[model samples]
Structure formats: C-alpha cells, structure tokens
Target: MKNLLFTVFTVAALFSACTNDADVKTFVNANGYTIYNDSLISFQKMIIEDGKVRQVGGEELSEMGEVIDVQGKTILPGLIDAHAHVMGLGFQELNINVAGIETLEATLDSIKAYAEANPELEWIQGRGWNQTLWPENEFPTAADLDKVVPDRPVWLTRVDGHAGWGNTKAMEMANISQDTPDPQGGKVIRDRTGKATGVFIDAAESYVTQHIPAPTAEERRLALEKALEKMASEGITSVHDAGIPAQTWELYKKFADEGNMITRIYAMIGGTGNDFDELSKNGPIKSYANDRLALRSVKISADGALGSRGAAMKEPYSDDPGNRGLLFYEQDELNEMVDKSVSNGYQTNIHAIGDRANDVVLNAFEQAIDEFGDQGLRHRIEHAQIVSLEDIPRFKELDLIASMQATHATSDMNMAEDRVGSERIKGGYAWQKFLDQGTVIANGSDFPVEHVNPFFGLYSSVTRQDHEGNPPNGWYPEERLSREETLRSFTLDAAFAAHQEDVLGSLEPGKWADFIIIDRDFFEVPAIEIWQTKVLETWVAGDKVYGNSD
Candidate 1:
C-alpha cells in the first residue's frame, strides 16, 4: 500500500510540473554556446522551465510560454571565479583604496587627502599600495605614510595583503617596540638600529590588526552587497570565496535566507582561525537556499606571497639571500590539518605560492588522501605559483586541482624572475605545463589583489602580457593557454573545482539557467580587446540580475 501511494504521489507531482505553462519561458535569437562533454556546443534558442534549463537547440517554437527575443546576442555560461575574497573585494571598494597609483608621492598624497576627508574616524584604514610600482622599487616604510598623515593612526596593506604599513602613531598604539619578538611564521620589519620599521609581514600583522576595530555586521553586509553588484556587472554569476570567518559565514547565510544574494557563492572556512572549529562540525553545507550558497571547503594558507619575499622556496630568494621564506606550519601540523578537513568531509584548498610550500602542501594532501581518502572531494592548491618542475606532475597524479590566477603572471612578470631566477621561472605560473599533463587548472582573478575582470585573466592567459601588450610574442610564449583552454579554466573547469559542474558550469539541460549576454562574441574578440569585453546582461536562474532595460 505504501509503495502504491508513493508512486501515485510521484506521478501527480510530475503531472503538475508538466502542466505548469507559466513556468516555461523561451529565449530566441541568441548565439548561445556552452561546454558540453569537453566540447563547445552552440545553439540558437534556449528553453527554461522553473529556473532550470529544459533544452537549448534550434527547434520550432511549439511550447506555450512567453517568447522573448534577444536579437542575436552572444550568450555564454556564467563565469566562475574559482578563488577570490568576496568581503575583501567589497571592502576594497568601500574603503579608501590606493590601487593603481603610479608613485609613492602620489600614494601619500591620496592617503593624506582621504584622511583629511574622513577625519571623524579614529583610525585611517586603507589598502592597495605596491612599492614595486614606485620609482624606488622597494617596500614603503611607515615613514613614507607618516610624512602624509602623522597625527592619524594610518594602517595600509600592500596589494598582496601579505604585508602591512603602519604609521608610527599606529605602531605606538599597538605597543610594538624594538624588544617585541617576531611571531612564528611572520616577520616584523626592523631597521639597522634595531627599531621597528612599522612594516609587519604575515603573522606579525596581527600585532597591529588586533588593535584595529572589526567591521560591524552592517558594514560587512554593505560590503557584500557592493561586491555582488561589482561581480554582476563583470558577468561573474558564481564565485568561490576562498575564505570566510564565522561572521562572514553568518552574513552569507543571512543573505541567502533573505533571498538577497544576486551572485552564487561557494564559501570555504578559514582554517587559520577558530572559525573552522565552530563551522566545520556540521560536515559541509553542500547546497543551501536553492543553491545560492554552499559551504563545503576549507582554505588553509601554507605560505605568504612572492611579492613580499615571504613565499617558502626550496632555495633562498635569488635577490634576498639567506631567506628561503617562512612556512606557516610544519609538515606534521599541516598533515594534521589536511587530514582533519578531509576526514570531516571538507574539500581542502591550501594557498601555496613558493616551491617549498607547494612541496609541503602536496605531501600533506597525499598523506590525507592516503589516510582519510579524498572522498572524491578534489583537493586543490591555490596560487600554485612557483612550483618545482619535478613536483608539477604530482598535481595530475594526486588528482588535485591547481587553482591559479592568470594576471599574477602578467603583474609579477617584472619582478618574479628577479625573486626566483632563471631555472625556477620555467615552472612558475606555467598554465600550459599543467594542462598538458591532464591536470585541471581552475582560473580566478584573486580580486582585490588583481582586478575583478575575468577578461583580464582570459587575455593574460592567452597572451601572457599586460594591458599594453608587452614582450611581443608573450612572456614564455610556449606556456600560454589557447583561447578555448583559458575559457574552460574560468568556466566549466572552475565549476568542477568547486564540485558544482553538474548544477552551474554549463547552460545545459537540467542545470541552473545561469548565463550572460555579452556585447560581442568572446571567441571572435581580438586578444588585446578581451579585457575590454562588456557584459550586456547577466542572468541567474533565468532572471535578469544586471542589465540596462531597453
């Protein structure tokens, strides 16, 4: 009797769904394309039912639903950033940012202007200062910031977020002194006279940050909304936020519950803090609130970034001798973390920039998989930046995902070789090397570090050059990815990395009807003009989220 009732109920539900003509909509005159079974498939029209794709092909219009004409616009699957910081991107816009400033003097001028404008705040907080861009080509000291805003406690972070520059007043408030010892896995830059230089690297940043006030929930909410708006405008319908604290996790939940989320988020617990202990106990939130949000991964930092010379290399930096760089954890400690994450049903993604850090993370993942088994979770190494040639093949062998940033190569091209030298550069930012070995490379902007534009990544991936088109043929031209390979990295491959390919990556049948209408065909755009590609309309779940209405 129970089986009979269940069968009747299932049949009734199916009948009801099929009878709902109001739920069906057809989009016509679209030059639609999506990756299907590792191949690009094209279609002329798409039929959607109940926020899911029903079919996408050139069939005579027989369905009884509203027919909308897109006027032959190009449509592609929504771009997904495999690794990025949502809140960080939001705050980068909300705060007084100094990114793209050409010189130290100009940066100071901007800082001073911002301080004067916002004198009501107790601490002047800002970011996006890169000393490499300055004529000096050196790290900016607190002295540089002091010359601008001496009275206010100015705290500025470098573009990489691995280092912090604080005014003397800010350091004084933190009680940092010459006698203060550097924390393990971090460094406090000091002068020849043994005095604090007001620059803190990695773990040492806590000395000052601990004193800075945390943003209120309301502030975070605004920041998130701002980030979503930015992403929608850029055609990013989904983003895998690399790390989220408990507060961020809570905010994401709140947004999802309230139906306020415009872009899909795949969040990861920040393993560096106690958020893991509190958040990871429930296993993982595989999907939530109609798949607008998911919390199934944990982000762990293995080492700092290369720009700060804090990346853990097997050999000492070619420029900074006697410093191979700092590792945040020993082999045993990292193994335990990886094992804990995998055993708890979390996809573990570790940030590894230098060769030594890559080696250590690879070992940790191997041990964890051997002990706890991967559970087919597809562990990843974020920023697989300066890996050794020998360890390159391990990515494919371990069935791991290399979550990499393309613009990093173009942005770091000027100084990367100076840090690691000739031989190591061969393996550094080698996207083609990983692709050739059958290893999946998921692309991202690492936004707020690099620009949030996916086209910048696409352009950089193919040309291996900056916006001005440097190095002619390209930087290490042989290592560049083809256009198809680059798009796959940012789209379907990225979705695979986040374990959401079945639902989000492609605009195929049964998947969420998430796609974007572009101003021009991405495939037909010139390599140099790729970065300038404009998103005409962004749609999620068959609803237009961002676009100008005609």
Candidate 2:
C-alpha cells in the first residue's frame, strides 16, 4: 500500500501533475530525518517552495499551495558521495567490468564473453580485476590473457585503478620488452629472468593506454548521463567528483547550462597537465546553474594505492620486505602544487593512501596554510588510509578534512594488515582515531572502485565488517562509527567538506529541497541490514528526479 502511494506520486511527477517549483507544497505523514545542529531530528510535515525547504515540523503546517501525503514513508537528506570518479564510473558501466568475479578462471571467461559480444571494439578495454581475490592470489600474466583474447589488444585495469593488466597483443603494440625502463613513480612487473610480465603499475599504465582511442564528445555525454541516472536511482543527490579532466568539465558545464543535471556535482579540477593550467587561471567557480554545479576544488594524486603495494609507506611491506611503496611526486614538487592551488582560492584535495604519502601531503598542506593562512578553504586528504599515529592529530590541528571511503576499509581488510603489519595497522582506516581528535571525515565509496551504492559505505562505516559479516566481531571493531556519525559523514559533514553546507545538506528551512524517500528507516534498521535499504524516490531541489515509476 505504501509502495502504491509512492508510485502514484512518481507517475504524477512524470506527467507534470506534481506541484511546480514556484508553489509551496506540503509533504505530510513523512518520517523525515535530517542532521541539524549536530543532532538527528525527526519531522512529520515539511513545506517546500521555490526549490528550498520552507518549513519543517512535527505537526501539519498551514497549507499554501498543495498538500501531498507521502503515506508514512521514511525520508532523509540525500546521500552525498565525497570521493568518486564520475567519468570513470560511467565508463565502467559501458565497458567490460569483471568487478565481482570470485576467481581468475571465471574472470577470464567473463572477459572472453564480453570480447565476443563486443566484436566491433578494436581494443578490448575494461577495469575492475582484483588479483588478490583469486585463489592463487597472484598477478596475472600476458599468457593468461592471450589464451582468451588472442586477436585483439586487451587492457584491463585493476580494481584499485593503480595497476593495469595487458595481454601480449597490447604489450606488443606498445613495444614493451625486458629492457623497457620503468618510469619514475611507476613499475613494470618482471619475471625471474627480467622479462616483462605485462603488468604496469601507476604511471607506467600510460604507455599501454595511450594507444586506445579517446571517446567522442557524444560518448562522454552519454556516459555522464548514465552516471547521473545511476546516482539518482541510488538516492544520491550530490557528488564531489574527485577529479575532472578538462573534457569532463566541459561536458558537466553543458549539462548544467541545460538544467539536465540529475545530481548536483561539486567538481575538483585535476591539478596537473594543460587542463589545470587552463582551468585554474580563471579561478574557482563557486556555483553555477542554480547550485547544480560547483568547481572550486583541485585534486592531486600524491601516491598510488595500497592494493598494488604502490602506496608510499614509511616502512617496507610486511609481506614484501626491503621495499617501501612509491610516491608520485617528490616533496618539493608536491609543495609547489599545493601552494599554487590554495593560493588561487581552491580547496585542495590530495590522494594519500600510505603513511609516507600521508606525511608528505600533511607537510605540503601545512606549508600551504602557513603561507596563505587557510582562508577558510577546507583542504582535504582523500583516502587517508594509512597514517602514522603521531600524524593523525595533525589532521585536526590543521583543520583538514579526511575525505575517506568507508568501504575501502572493508575491501582492504584482508590484505591491509598483511601489508603494513599489526602496529601500523592501528592508524589504517582509523575512523575513531580521527573522530577522537575532532577531525571531520567526509565519507564516500570511491564508486566503480567499490560499489556505487552509498548504503554500502554506510554499512561498512557503521559495522566495520564485510557484507557477509566476516570476522563476526568486526575488523578493528574499535574503528567502527556510530550510525549517527556515519549518516552525518555522508550528509551534512560531506556537504561541509565541499563548502556547500550553507545551501545544501539538510532539510532546514533555508536548505535546498534535496532529499529521498527510502524503503526503510536507516536509523532503525539493524546494522547488518543497512545495505539492503532501497530508494523509493529521489528528489533534487523539490523535483522528483528518480522514482520507482521508471
């Protein structure tokens, strides 16, 4: 019966029978929940007018335009993903994705099927192959791929996006050989006899990937649309696109100008290459197209990921002795980049996954702040995955945000401790430690790297466990976040990270009418069942953007 009522509203929205944006519409009988004044509040009635919340209360308010009862549905502020790759997620959907394949044999079969299905694709391109998940837990070889995809060149990126697996055809096309020197901050895996193993890590991926044809403008538009639709359906109304190349920024602008954006995007321009030089010169764009788009942040990659043993650690890996991880840039180079970004009035967000990388990023950020005085720009460290215990408090002291992906902890639990060992592991994905030091964490899923569903992140944050409930006591149970903390991290706190807290984040009177009606109350659901919660309707700026009617 509740679903029927929800469907009715959705259908009405589709035909323009719903209240117009200019009119004051009262939504009644809703179990509304939102974070306000650092507390979760409940409201039964709310009024929305001109794409903003007008009033919210426990009792019915005076009706001004139209009254619609949501029939006792659960409503909450729209989830915000603070660290996602928008274009990458879109491409993952469009290409051959083997994200969840349990074994190498199955993964190969899946790849073979995809190649056979897409016969027109000259180069078979895909991502989301995790070598660690295979039974043998070994990186795949060119021979392994050649058996399945012999004719066409094939390149598959690891799930972390820090490594790439190329078939013999692809490597041959790039003219890779045993003598091919490793690029700075990157490596080409080699066998015992110094022969290329067809695996490229970090910067070396560019050699093989440069040959693939770039997507046309129309293709990019389609991919963006697909990503927006997916975000809407999952109840996400806003996304902090972690990094945007110049081409993606142009596409996002087109969508915003046309008012075609389904989810609000807070984009961070890539802080390197010709795009950075071009975009940053004009300064930051605080807001555009009715707050549907904002480009005021710069994203810099300081190091690689932990999955591929590429994260820059202070000490050598526990599993692989005598070898620490890689840092993408030297200290002086990173300091200059951060200083340039903050000086230009941009919120700088750097990706630092290992202890050494984190240390370097913190130093860079501190130097930038000292030179420019922070200026109220909330600099962030994306994936503060591994940190020295001594450096953890520096986050709070410097007023920097830890833009973390909760699911990364759950996903990396199997190997994180193995890589860093027991003692250093204490500061790995240390949510409680950050919170204890008064550091704010902006949570996300790093979608396509993990799953796109925000609920997956919420569950992981609160439970500190895998979907199947591994380690029953939770992996590092001490680091688990409370339900309220997790919700705030994804909603209000995330908005704060993007500097959109003034106009977004909550159901307050002056906030944007961006919220969602879900099937279950997130606050009341059992911790283990949080991931099962589904979105019944998603509203952005008081308009239904996605619903079950679709």
Q: Return the TM-score for candidate 1, rounded to 2 decimals.
A: 0.95
Candidate 2 structure quality by residue, lDDT tens digits, 195-220? 88989999999989998889988878
Evaluate model 2: give its lDDT.
0.89
lDDT of 1 by residue, 1-550 (tens): 1111111000011223344477788888877778877777667778788888877776453443778788888888999999899999999887889987989899999999989998898899888888888899877788888898999798988888899999999999999988989897899999899898988999999999999999987888899999999999899999999988888988988988888899999999999358988997777999999889999999999999898999999999999999998899999999989888888889999999999999999999989878876589999999999999999999998999999999999999989999999999999999989999999999999998989988889899989988988998999999998877887898899999989999988977789999998887777767888888889899999888999535
Candidate 1 Cα deviation (angstroms), residue 66? 2.5
| C-alpha TM-score for every candidate | 0.95, 0.95
Model 1 misplaced regions, further than 4 Å: 1-20, 59-64
Instruction: Give the least accurate 10-residue stretch of model 1, judged by summed lDDT.
Output: 3-12
The root-mean-square deviation over C-alpha atoms between each candidate and the true structure, in angstroms, is 6.6, 4.8
- Cα displacement (Å) at residue 257, model 1: 0.7
- Candidate 2: list runs displaced more than 4 Å: 1-22
